[model samples]
Target: MLFILAAIVLTAHAASYGVDIAESISTSSIKCLRDLGFNSFFIFRAWRSLGSFDPNAKSINENALAAGFSAKHIDAYFYPCFSCGDPAGQVKSFWNQVTSKKLKFERLWFDIEGTWSSSKSSNRKFFESLTNEAAAIGIKSGIYASYYNWEDIVGLDYKFSRAGSWPIWYPHYDGKKTFSDFKSFGGWTSPYMKQYNGDMTACSHDVDYNYRP
Candidate 1:
């Protein structure tokens, strides 16, 4: 039937598309993002390095809730910026924010970078603790890192263990390329998401475009 064929066509076109934004990107709004071809969003809930929370996350969560966005349509994550005064305490603070504000997300991602880790052992330990904390709270977690960051900070021979099992949202950008160009980074093979464009202008707002495959 023509109706059944049309349903299949729309189903194939319903692949997930998302964008990641932080408080620093002041122009970004949930309404504009959704209107500009993005069906899902990954908003920063907290930044550990600053030893504080991002107030924007709460607003975005509220906006998404009011807009009737489902959990499958949004993701909230915490970013632990470089070597802070207390890594363990930073993780705890992020946990507290989620509970107090009642934020909900299907998955969390750890923003890993080269400048964050002091040494391989310390870097490994940070992820180990983050993984444990995520497990306790009943949330799936992943790593957001480029291959260069993983090798530069964590060492090429480093064994990630529990954290290694976490999905990777690889960032290997080459402007205006197909998602098939997304390559494996660090120790992860077959990344869960590909950030294809970092400096993309969508709805007149700068956003990092991502594809969920």
Candidate 2:
């Protein structure tokens, strides 16, 4: 019984930590993060805001994998530029760049913060186009947004059909490393992961600390 209890505690702790990175870092830096208890890594696959792919994405992902992080625990995220238009094209570009480099990731997370168009309908359509394109390519997708950002960009009352089923990664930046403060938004009653801290350096690498529980 004691052994079982200890195993349960270990499992729970292992499932609760992650980090997302935009900058390129060495494999040793990734191993450092792993040593600090971050088991999951989310790397930026695209930067639509800059109208280009993240040049460092593949390298960061490769470093994480080299550090012994499983592909299943490493994922990709796309920062969409609402004004860039051609949402479908953006998705295709993201998919192409990631595949071209053979980066390993389990899912694609759509970063849904920042400025949006004045028209909510247009914003919703843009989002739908992105997800639709991702679905057509057979890649699973998720969303990363906070309640305020969702409300500002997509409206508080707006809910997508797949929002409930799609995994959500929300940010709070309270430095708590837990999901106690998450509020339902965009049809997500709970979050699959929480970004509890932002713009911090750990092990000589810049990262946003995240947790999944």
Best by lDDT: 2
lDDT of 1 by residue, 7-35 (tens): 99887566667777664433335566776
Cα deviation of 1, candidate 2, in Å: 12
Query: How far in Å is the alpha carbon of 56 misplaced in model 1?
Result: 1.6
Question: What is the C-alpha lDDT profile of model 2 across 74-95, one tens digit per residue?
Answer: 8888898777889899888878
Cα lDDT computed for each candidate against the true fold? 0.68, 0.83
Q: Candidate 1, residue 47: CA error in Å?
A: 2.5
In model 1, which runs have C-alpha deviations exceeding 4 angstroms? 1-14, 24-28, 163-165, 176-179, 182-186
**Candidate 1 Cα deviation (angstroms), residue 15:** 2.7
Clashing pairs in 2: none
Q: How does model 1 score by TM-score?
A: 0.81
State each candidate's clash count: 1, 0
